[model samples]
Each structure stands twice: as C-alpha cells, then as structure tokens.
Target chain A: MADKVLIYSRFPKTMMARFAERFELLDTGGKPAQDVFSGNELAGIRALLTAGGSPLGAEAMDRLPKLGAIVCYGTGYDGVDLKAAAARKIAVGHSPGANAASVADIAMTLMLAATRRILIADQYVRSGDWASSRQSPMMRPQAGMPGRRIGVYGMGEIGRKIAARCAAFEAEVGYFSRTKHDLPYQYFPSLEALSDWCSVLMIAVRAGAETQHVVNADILKRLGEDGYVVNISRGSVIDEKALVAALSDKTIAGAGLDVYQEEPHAPDALTVLPNVVLSPHIGGHTLDSHVAMQNCVLANLTAFFAGRPLPHAVKTA
Target chain B: MADKVLIYSRFPKTMMARFAERFELLDTGGKPAQDVFSGNELAGIRALLTAGGSPLGAEAMDRLPKLGAIVCYGTGYDGVDLKAAAARKIAVGHSPGANAASVADIAMTLMLAATRRILIADQYVRSGDWASSRQSPMMRPQAGMPGRRIGVYGMGEIGRKIAARCAAFEAEVGYFSRTKHDLPYQYFPSLEALSDWCSVLMIAVRAGAETQHVVNADILKRLGEDGYVVNISRGSVIDEKALVAALSDKTIAGAGLDVYQEEPHAPDALTVLPNVVLSPHIGGHTLDSHVAMQNCVLANLTAFFAGRPLPHAVKTA
Candidate 1:
C-alpha cells in the first residue's frame, strides 16, 4: 500500500499528477480537511503537500494525528506555521533554492521592463502613434542600465542572481541583507542606506513577520523622483498603499511588480496607473522550476515515508 | 562669424540647441535642400549634419558643392553614400559606439519581453483575468535565462555589450562575425551554424549592401520552433515577409523588433501577430546616449571646420 499524502492547497491537476502516481492522495481541493475527508481518513494521513504561501496552522495539523512532515512546494514557507509545527515535533521540508534562478530571471524582466518603459512603447506602436508621428511625453528618453545603481534588499539565492545580472549590464550593484556574504557587490548595513544610494531598488528578501511592510512610505520617498522599484518577492515586503501613493505623486518614477498584497487580485488603482507595470505573481512559475521543485517534493515525501529525515529539511528557530 | 552647417534632417529644437550655440545652422526642417535654401546658401555650405538612417545620395551631396564634411548624428552611417563622399574628398564622421550601451540595453529589454511574454501577462492582469482566476494559454511556464543559448550575429561594440549582458544572466553565449576576435564566447563560422546551435538569435550586425536580407527563410527554419529572434540593428537584416510568415505559422517561437524595413510604419500583418513585441526603433534614444552622440558630432564638426581631418571620420572602402 502506498503512503497517504493530504493535499492542503489548491493546485492544478497536472501539477499533482506525478504525486498521485507515487502516493494515495487525499486532496481537499483547498477546502477544510473535515469537509473533504472523514475523521478516520484525515487521522491516517502521514504527510501533507502545501503551497509555501498558503496558511497551514496548528489546528489543521492537529486533525492529522499521524502527520510527521509538512512539505512545502516552493522556496517560501512563510504561510506555514513553523512554530506550531516545531512544538508538535513535525519536520518541515521545502525546495530551498529550486526556483531561485527562475525568480531571479523575473526580477530582471521586471527591472528592464520598468526602466525602459517597454509597455508604453508597445502601446505607442500598436496604437498607430508612431506611424502618425504623434508625440508622447511618455516616449521621452530614459536612463540606461550602464552606470546606474541597483540596490538589492536581500542577498539570498534570488538576490545574488539579480545582483550578478545587474552587474553584467555595467550597473553598480549593492545589497542589504541580515547576514553579509563574501560577494563582489558592495554591502550596505541597512535598507535605507541602500535605497538612498541606488536609483533602482529590487526587493528579494524572504517573507516573515520581521520583514512585513518593511518597504513603506519612507523607503519609497528615499528613492526620490527619478527612481524605480522592482519587487519579485512576497507582496508583504512592501506596503501596497504607500507604493500607489508614491507612484501617483511622482515620489518614485515607476514600479514593476509580479507579486501583490492580495494574490489573484491587484487593486484597480494599481492596475490603472500609467507609470507601473503589473503581472500576476509568477516569479518562480517556469517549466524548469516546476520540475526541479517537484523533484524536491518527491525526495522529501519519500524520505518521510521511509522513516528517515528529510534531506532538504528547513531548520526552525 | 560662425561656420555654416546645414541641418540635413529634422531634429527637435532642444536636441539642436547646443549645436546652434556654436554654429550658423541653416535648418531645412527635413525638407529638400533646394526647397528650403537659396542657391547661394546651398553653394556656400561647407559642412552638414544628418541622421544616420536618412538617405544622402550623390545628388544630395552635389547640391552642397562646398560640403567638406558630413557628420552623422549616430553610430550607424549606412544611409550615407560612402563612395560618393570618398570621390568628392568629403570626409564622413559618425558617433561610433557612442550609443552602443543604450542600444544593447533595448536588445535585452526586447528579448526579455518577448521570451517571457510580458505584454500578455500585463494584459492578463489589467483585463481582470488574473483577478478572476482565469487561465491563459500564454501564461504557461516559460524557459528561464540560465543555461539558455544566445547567439549574437555580429561582434561590433553593440554586439559585444549584448553578449556580455546575456552572459551575466548565465546564458551560454555564442556568435558569428565577419572576422573572429579573441572573446570569451564560442564563435561559429557562419550565421546558419550559430542559429542552429542557439535558441535565441540576436541581430546586431552593421547594416550595409553586403548584409541585406541575410537572415532569410532558410535561416529562420534553422532556428526551428522553440527559438526567438531579437533584432536591434536594422530591419533590412531579415526579410520582413519571411519573418511574418515564420511567426504566423509557428516556424519560430517569436520575435522582438526595434526597427522595421520602412521607417515609422510597420505592416499591419506583422503588427496583428500576438507573439511578437514591437518598438519604434528607439534603440539609441536614451538621454545619456543622445548626449554622448551629440558630443561626438560636435567634435567631428569642430575639427572639420578648423580645416583638419575629422576626429571621428569613417574610413571608406
């Protein structure tokens, strides 16, 4: 008999196809556990698969009496109640850097798009503005990447990759992280200093309570009128309201965002802004990234069922 | 009295303000020299300024009999009749490599936008599809930059910068140029071989009679179905009809174009395609690049008027 793994989050059927072949999945279809499965079925579940940004608390864990591991599908595990899991002696595992490259690639995409005003240019061409020789203030010349300052907020896998890419464009790179690493980029002690020095600020910090709303009005103000911000990390890292106000008043020139305060829904105010470029939160949603993450998920579940420690387990405080 | 310099192309007043301060400019407002100036004025003209892409054939050069110098405002001087200038002992100068970095940056912007389908994603969000949890075929996972092959067709200043930027993104860089140089990227003997080996073909070759329509139907077929082409050099490098057909029939994945065969007008058939991303040939239209190119133009004109060889003169065949 195959081990039973409860699916605690909503995922595409195709994404769960591989897992279904290996385990007898008790999928809740993103609903409450008791509503989807009987007490006996829930009680027998030994492991659960979840999106790292979906909330999974102690109450949900208590329902699965035999639960031994909580496996997160992506790099971030912010939505998982780590402290609650720790107290229950439940091991937490995640695909640590599996999607880092893809996420970093999106960061670069957003950075280049915002800095170059590509969306506006695309519209200008499509609307026959170019053919008519109509002048648009938005089509004015912009600053290129060379000699521009790019400040990264975190220096983890994604941040490091972003820094390396920016440096290749001849942009001077700097970063602020909790712990400094021996990298080629200049290190800043605080986010404020980094924002003040750089014209483009890239947010790649991990999502946690300590980092929530760290990039607020003051930080946006520090970026000044000719600055830009690119966020590929969690939406919680920035105060969305403040960002809108900053862009509206020209406090900061523009922004390119792949994440939002609310998933599957960005504010109408943000959507209508001419200076901003918005996309659904898809930083790590690449074909290669999904395969790598699935590999990690399989490895973690296999080890847990085999009565062994997870090779990619996350260390909890 | 200041030296007479005929403005051979239309320029914004602001861009010409600096030149006006030092020269006696006879602005033609992009009109024919005969229509805008008297015979005396045209005959006395010893120097002229022109946009690099504007045509200046022998007839036009003959109109200004005393023309000693033809100063091009940008790196490319393809439209100038080099043979005609050389026969007349008229020196030709251009802002060579002055806008290379800016042009390279646009190449990257177009590459990332097309490869990642940024325009589609932006529409998905703004159209409320993302907010409503709607599925889009275009939103499917894409291949990231890391480990992707990028083939540059030229090794000029712009091509070298594009290769370096792509390399920083962790892409495997390759190229094919007229003469091989000592560079870090793998060099191919021909564009056909380079296109076959790489997934993304970056067109950065100099525009000239010898290189017209080199990337034809056969070359597009070599790229196959999962390939992309980004052209920042000139539209004449690729056959527009072949490119439109390839993109429409899915012979190649997509394209990002900054230039078109016809100035200020792209064909409706090409514009209607969803896979391609278009820009209005603003590759070197950055503030810093304009300033740099203007400085080079000033230097060339200053030297020519002083009865010396033009400082930035282009060696003709």
Candidate 2:
C-alpha cells in the first residue's frame, strides 16, 4: 500500500506528478487540508507535505493523528507549531540552504536600490522631466558604496553571503551575531554598536520571538542621518512603526525593505514615505530557488517513508 | 608686480577670497573669457586661471602671447589643446584625484541603480499601485544581485575604488586595463574578454581620440542578454547611438549613464527608453568634490607661480 500524501501549498505540476508516481497524492491547491486531517475527507494518510508560510497550527496538527511525517517545502517552518507535531511523534523536516544564492541576490539588490536612489531618478525622468527636468539640470550626484561601512545583523548563511557582497563593494563589512565567528572582519557585540559604525546596515537574521525587533528604535537611531537600512530577512525582525517614523523624520537616510512586519498588507504610511524603497516579499521565490526547495521537500519525504535518515529533519521536539 | 590672474569658473566665496589674497585675481563671474582669448578684452593678463572644458584652440593660445602659465581648475584638458599650450610654452596644470573619490561614489551609485531596479519599484509604489497593485499580488519573489561578476574597464584610481564598492555588494570584481596592477581581485587582458565574463560593466577610462567608443557594438553584444553597462567616465567612452539601439532591441539588460556625448542635451531616443537610466553630467560635480577640485586648482596655481612644484600638472605639449 502506498503512503497517502496531502500537499498544502502550490507546486509545479511536474513536482506534483513526481509525488503522485510514488505516493497516494492529493492536491489541496493551497486550500487548508482540514478535511484530510479531521478524518472526514480521507483516512490513514501517513504523510503531510506543506510549504513555509502556511498556517499549520496546533489544531491542524491535533487532527492529523496518523501522520507519521510532516515535510516543510521551504526554509522557514515558523508557521507550524513544532511542539504539537513533536508530541505526536511526527517526524518534522524542513528544507535548508535551498534558496541561499537567490535570497543573497535580492538582499544586494535592495541595498543598492536604497543607496543609489534608483527609483527616484527613474520617476523624475518618467514624469516628463526631459523638457523641464527637475533633477537633470541641477541634480546632486549620488554617493556610491565604496569606502562606506556596511553592517550585517545575524551572520547566518544568508548574512554571510550578503557580507561577502558588501565586501566586494569595497565597504568595510561588520556584523552583529549572538556569538562571534572566526572571520577577519570586525564583529560588533551588538546591533546598536554595529549600526553606529555603518552607513548602510543590512538585517539578514531569522525572524522569531527571540530575534523579533532586533532592529528596534534604539538601533535605528544609531544608524544616524546619513545611514540606510535594508531588511531581507523577515518582517518580524524589524519594528515597522519605528522604521516609518525614522524615515519621516529623516533620522535615517533611507530604507530598502523586502519583508515588512505585516506583509502583503504593508503599512500605508511606508508606501507613501519618500525615503523608503519597498518590494513585495519575494526574496526566495526565484524559479530556480523554488525548484530547489521543492526538490529538498521531495527528498525528505522519500527518505522518511522509506524508514531511512531524512535529509533535513527539523528536530522540532 | 605679481602676475595678473583671470578667474573664469564659479567658485564659493571662501575659495574666491583665498584666490584673491594670493594673486591679482580678475573675476569674470563664471564665464570663460571668449573675448579675452580673441584679444578683444582683458588684453594685459599675464597668467590664466581657467577651469577645464574651456575651448582653448590654437587661435586662443596665439592671442594670449603673454600667457606664461595655464592652470586648469579640473582634470580633462580636452578643452585646452595641449599641443597649442606647449607650443606657446604655457605650463598647463590640472586638478586630478581631488574629485576622484566623489566621482567613484557616483559611478557605484549608477551601477547599483541599474542592477537593483530602484526606479522601477519606486514608480510602482508612487503611481498608486500598492492599493491596486497587479505586479505585487501575483508576483513571485524577484532576485537581486549577489555573487554577480562586475567588470571595470579602467583599473585606475577611480576604477579601483569602484571595484572596492562592488566587493561590498558581494560582487566578484574583474577589470581590463592596458597594464596590470597588483590588486587583490582578478584582472582581464581585454575589454571583450571582460565583457564575456561580467554581468555589469563600468567604464572609467580617460576619453579622447584613442579611447573613444571603447565600449562599441561588439563588446556590448559580448556583454550578452542580461548585462548592464554603467558609464561615469567621459560620454565619448561609449557609443551612445549603439547603446540606444541595443536598449531599444533589448540586446543587453540596461544602462546607467551619467555623462553624454553632448552636454545638457541627451538623445531623445535614449531619454524615452524604459530600460535605461539617465543622469545629467553631474558625476563629479558634487559640492564636496567641487570644493576639493577648487582647492587643488588654487594650490596648483599658487605653487606654479611661486616656482614651487605644481600639485597637479597636466602632461601635455
């Protein structure tokens, strides 16, 4: 008998077809698989496949009594309640290092965008400024990143990648992590100290209760009037209200934000602020990256059901 | 008696006062003495304190027979004919390296602007797209730059500085120069070879007959489909017409230009293009850079007249 599988998030048909080849696959089309777990839709389902950012709450875990394995299809498994899943002896696994390069790419892009004033210059050109150009005739040339200091908060894999890029720009790269790494660049004991030293600060730490508001009002102030801040990590990592106020008052030079505190429904004030550059949260959503994340999920699922060591077991319990 | 000094460029009051105290300063209120060079005005001036970009042809040099020293206020003596100046035994000095850091900063800014999609995203928000945003809602997360290869055309001081900035962004930097330097990064032998390897190429070489259109159609095509070109050097360094055609056809990714073939007026086709970013010729004209350049020019003038070594003498005939 095949292991019954329920997919809770969107995936390419190719991946779904691959899953169907081995398991008793059921496509949820990103709908909440409450029926499958509640024993109403289908019984004896042994596997659960879900992507990151899906709501797999305690109630959802309690319903899936027969679920032997739960595989997260992306890097962050914050949405799922790990303790509940662990209590049921359900093996939880999440994909890791799948989207590092792509996320790193986006981080660099946001930093560059914030520093260069690219968006502003383009709008000036587009608003029929050719004949009577406001910026062209008497524009101040932009300050580039060379000889500038760049600070990275949370020197994880993504943070390290960003640091390498910042280093390439001839910026003195510094970092603030919980524990110091054996690296040549200077390590600040705290984010506030790091922010004070850097003209451009990039937040690349994970988002959680402990790491939430890592870049709070105090650290923001330390960034100073000529400093820019970029967040490519998680929305919960920064205090969006404080960021908006800082930007409005010109306490910070600018911000380039990929993820916000409340995403999709970003604060209306942030969108209106002239000093901020905003992007919809899509850091790890590249076609190449998505495929990589999906492959990892599939590999983990395959190993779990085969009674072998899973490739990326989350160790949630 | 002290040599009669003619001031042509507009400088700050503090700088002006400094020059006045040192020489018999003749203030022309930012206008280059077209009449004075034609023997129509200021006929008895023994020394010329002119800025670069002043048209000093053979006739102008011939008219100024008493001109013992020609101290240009900036680099690039293309405006002042070196052959003519040398024939008249005029000591031509220019302010070099004074504004290099500022210009380098702007170059990195332009490159970052082109790579990061700053203007495009800014317009998306400013155009009331957030509330009724089509791109944001259905968008897969986009990628930005990290681990991208950046090519610098000239490995001079400015080019080296730009490389340093590229490093900060985690960019793998390479450069093509006539001779190799003992730098930390990789060096390419030719522009074509560099174009083949780099996604973003920066032009920072001196502009003249020998170096004109160094980035031509062939090299641009070699930069390939997803490449971006940034020109912060002289406008003559790039083939503007070819760049426009490439941008029109989407041959390369995009371009960020600060200088143009014609000052004040850019090509209408280039101005209208969506993919390219344009700036008026303000690459090295920042307030800080201007003051620095002026000081350098003053120092060159003071030293030349005092029979001290000229600070920034232009190597010319």
Candidate 3:
C-alpha cells in the first residue's frame, strides 16, 4: 500500500517519473477537464502539487477531502486559497529561495540591457541604415558600466543578489529595506534616498499589498535626469502613470521592466518611450529554477506525508 | 619665457584659456583649412597636443623638426610615428588607464544588453505587436544572476575589470590570455577550452597584428548552441564572416557586438540575424571618458613641458 499523490498542474516529465517511483502517484496532470469533483477524481489523495497562474479555487479544494497537504511549485502562492486550506487543516507549503539566482540574473540583465541600449543598436545595424545613422559625429558615445550608481529597493534575497552583480560592473551600489541588515553595503533609510543616490534603480521586493506602488511619482522625481529604473519584482511596486510622466518629461533617463500592474498589457505610454525597456513577467521561470521549484514540491510532499514540518509555510495571509 | 605649445586639436574654450594662462599656447584650434604643415603651422612648435583617430603622416613630422614631445590625448597612438619620435628624441606619452574603466563599463554593458535582449524587447513592446510576440516564450528568465559561466579573452585591464564585475553576478569566471595569469578564477589554457566552459564570452583585448582573428570559426563552433559572444574590443579580433556563419547556422545562441571590422559598415548577415546584438564603435567614447582623455592630454602636456616622466607610454607599435 502506497500514499496517493494529486498533481494540480502540468509538470516536467522528469519530475513526474521521479514522483511516481516514490509513491502511487495519482497524476491529475492538468486542470480538471470537467469539474474537479468528477467521480473519484480527488479520492484517496494524501497530498496536492500546485503552481501559480492557474486558479485553484475553493471548489477544487472542496473535492480533496483526503488531502493532508498542498505544495506550491513556485515562490508565490497567489493561485492557492490559503484561507480555505487552513480551514481544511491542510498544511500548505511554498518553494522558497528556489528562484533567487534566476530572478537576480534577470534583474542584472535588465539593468544592463536598459542602460546600454543593446536592442536599439542591433536594430540600427540590421536595418541597413547603419552608414547614415551611425556615421554622424554628433551621436553620443555608448556609455559603459563603470562609475554608474545602482540602487536596489527591498534588500531581501533577490535584491542582495542583484546588488552583488551590479557591484561587479564597478557600479556603486546602495539599498533600502524596512530593517537594516548588518551587511557591508551603504543602506539607505528609505527608497527615495536610494533612488536619489543611483543612476539605475532596481526593484527586487515581493509582490503583494504591502509593497504596492512603493515607487510612485515622488520617487521618480528624486531619481532625476540620467537615471534608469528596473523592476523585476512585481508591477504593483511602481505607479505606471508616474513612470510614464517622468519618462515623457525627461525627468529620469530610462527604465527596464519585467513585471507590470496589469500584466501582459503594459501601458501604451511606457511601451512608446524610447528610453524605457520592458519584458514579460518571466523572471524566476528558468528551466533550472523550474526544476528546483518542482524538487522543493516533492520534498514538501514527502515530509508532510511522514508527519514532518512543512518546508515553506505561509504564516500569514 | 613660456615655451611655445602647439595645440594640435580642437579644445573646449575654457580649456584653451586655462592652457594659454599656463603656457605660450598656439591656436590651431579649429578644423584645419589646409594641410597642417604646408600652412606654416609648425614653424616654431616645441610641444604637440595630439588628437585620436586621424593619422599624423610623415609630412607633418618632417615640418615639426623642433618638436620635442607628442602628448597623445587618447589610448591609441597609431597616428603618430613612434620610431620617428624616438629618432627625433621626442618622447611620446598617452592616456592608458583613463579609458580602461570606461571601456570595461561598455564591455559589461554590451554583454548584459546582448544576453538579455533588452532593446529587442523594448522594440517589441513599442512596435504595437506585443500580443503577437508574447505567444512565443522567451529563452531565459529575467534577473537570474547566479550559476552563469562567463569567459574573458585577452585578460588585460578591461578584461580583468569585466571579470570582477561578472563575478559579482556570481558567474563562474574564466579567462584565456597569452600567458596564464595567477588569477583567482580558473584560466583555460586555450581559447577552445574557455569557449567550451563558458556560456558567455567577452572579447576585451587590443586590436593589432598579435590578436587578429583570435575568435574564428573553430572557437565559435565550440561555444555551440547555448553560448553567447560579446565583443567590446576591436572588431578585427573576430572573423566577421565566420561569426555570421555560426549565427546563421544557429550553431551558437547569439552575440552582442560594439566593434566591427569595418567602421559604420557591419555585415548584412549579422544585422539580419535576430540573435545578434550590434552597436556602432562608441565603447570608450562616453562624455566621462572624453573628459578624462582631455585631462590626460593636459597631464601629458604638463609633464613633458615640466621634464617629468610620462605616466603612459606606447612601448610597442
């Protein structure tokens, strides 16, 4: 007799095989085709493996009467109903520090891309107007990494990692957090102070109610001319309207963004700005990081079935 | 009495006045109306303040018989005849480290820009076809810094600086130099070995007889499917045709280039490739670097007139 596993999301086949070898894996593989409560779909399920982006509604939770635990295969558990899980005495676990390296890499990449205008130059050369456009003497020379200041807002794991990478470019690094960590960096008491101190301001905080619109119009004003902003955390951290105004007025230099408030639909104003850089919210979604997240899911499942403490729990809502 | 100072290139108005107050400055300040020597420009010139890019031919050297020293404003002294300077007992001094930091910064900038596709993403958003493009998933996640391998060729000052910065990203840093340096990071004995090891390769060496076509077809093949190449050094260091072949064949992932074999003229094949990132040669030509170069010119001039040792000298051709 083996413990039964319920997978709520489609995962890599490698991980699925590994899970099957360990338990009598009842792979539900994808979103419930009809309703989640279809005949015996959730019966004998001891644990559930889930992910973000897909809605795991209360109705789905109600079907899993035997579900003892739920594991999120990502840092965020936005799709999971934590309140509902607590009501059912389901131990919910989320993967932590699994995607830090990937997210940090993207942040640094965004900063570099936004600052250097890589895509712009490439397009110029490719479009066959290289001779007329580039030969002009008045064109400003490409500025490099050294002597630039980079400010990291929210000095948590991702922010610290980004700060280290920026420092490698010989850029002076500063950061702001709620509590001062005894690190060897110049800590700003506030985000505005950090923005004022840097040419590139990178956001690497969590995306939730607490950090929404932290980088508003006032902060953009302080970032000033010849400054760039990069956001890889969450779109909610910045006021999109403020960012557009600043870029339009040339109050700040530029921006590199990977996340947005509405998501998949960035502001038309931001999209049109010559100085701004944008990417889809694909940070921390690398193949390597995905594997890590899945592994964390497996570990949480194994531990919970053995009556062990959940690896990563959401203490609060 | 002040010694006669020949101002070889245009200078800022304030800088010229400062020089005039310091010495008996000659005003060959604007673009020359005719040949520099034919117009009696060098009749009594004892010291020369030189410009970069334009060549100082044999004719100019012949007329400036009494010229005791040539103070080069930038790094490259290809314009000046070093042998002639040595024969005439005219010491030649140049600014070396002044642009090292700037060049290093540009190299890292190119690397980041190229690898992350910042400009491409920006253009995608701006072109009003963001929805169409979002259907295809991106290659790498955003802001993931750690566990990347970065290889540096020609491990000089700029290369070393780039290595330090890449390390800050928590990348596994490696290098291939003429001789193995006692560096903290791993040193690949050959270019092939380094290419095999690194996902990203940065070229930061001098461009001359010694390092021509160092990154050719063979090395590109070794870099393979997952690898990226960034050239901040001279374009002559890479074989443009071979690079285009690799890129077109999809043998390697992509490239970020700031230099080309032909100025203002890049290969059509490279420009057309979606993976390749291109830029006009402005890596070391930033405002900050230009100001530094001017200051170096001042320093070299001051030193030569005062009979002090030159800080940076071109020892070889």
Interface RMSD of each: 0.9, 4.0, 3.1
lDDT of 1 by residue, B109-181 (tens): 9999998899999999999998776778888888878889999999999999999999988899999999999
Relative to the real complex, the DockQ score for model 1 comes to: 0.82
Per model, how much of the real contact set is kept?
Answer: 0.79, 0.32, 0.62
Estimate every model's Cα lDDT from 0 to 1. 0.91, 0.73, 0.73
Better of 1 and 3 by TM-score: 1
| Residue-level lDDT tens digits of model 1 in A1-317 | 99999999877777899999999998887788899999988989889999888888999889998889999998989988999998988999999999998898888888888888999998888889998878898988888888999999999999998999999888999999998899999999999999999989999999989999999999999999989999998889999999999999999999999998877788998999989888788888888889999999999999999999998898676
Reference-based TM-score, model 3 = 0.82
Error of 3 at A153 (Å): 1.6
Is candidate 1 or 2 superior in lDDT?
1
Model 3: per-residue lDDT, tens digit, A47-100? 877765446767787777777788877776666777887888888888777888
A235 in model 1: Cα distance from truth in Å?
0.1
Model 1 segments beyond 4 Å from truth? Answer: A38-40
**A147: Cα error in model 3, Å:** 4.5
Give each model a TM-score. 0.97, 0.81, 0.82
**CAPRI classification of candidate 3:** acceptable
In candidate 2, what are the lDDT values of residues A85-137, reduced to their tens digit?
77787788887878776677677777765665655555554454633534342
Error of 3 at A117 (Å): 2.8
lDDT of 2 by residue, B48-130 (tens): 77656556777866655677677776566666778877777778888787677666766776765565555555555456564
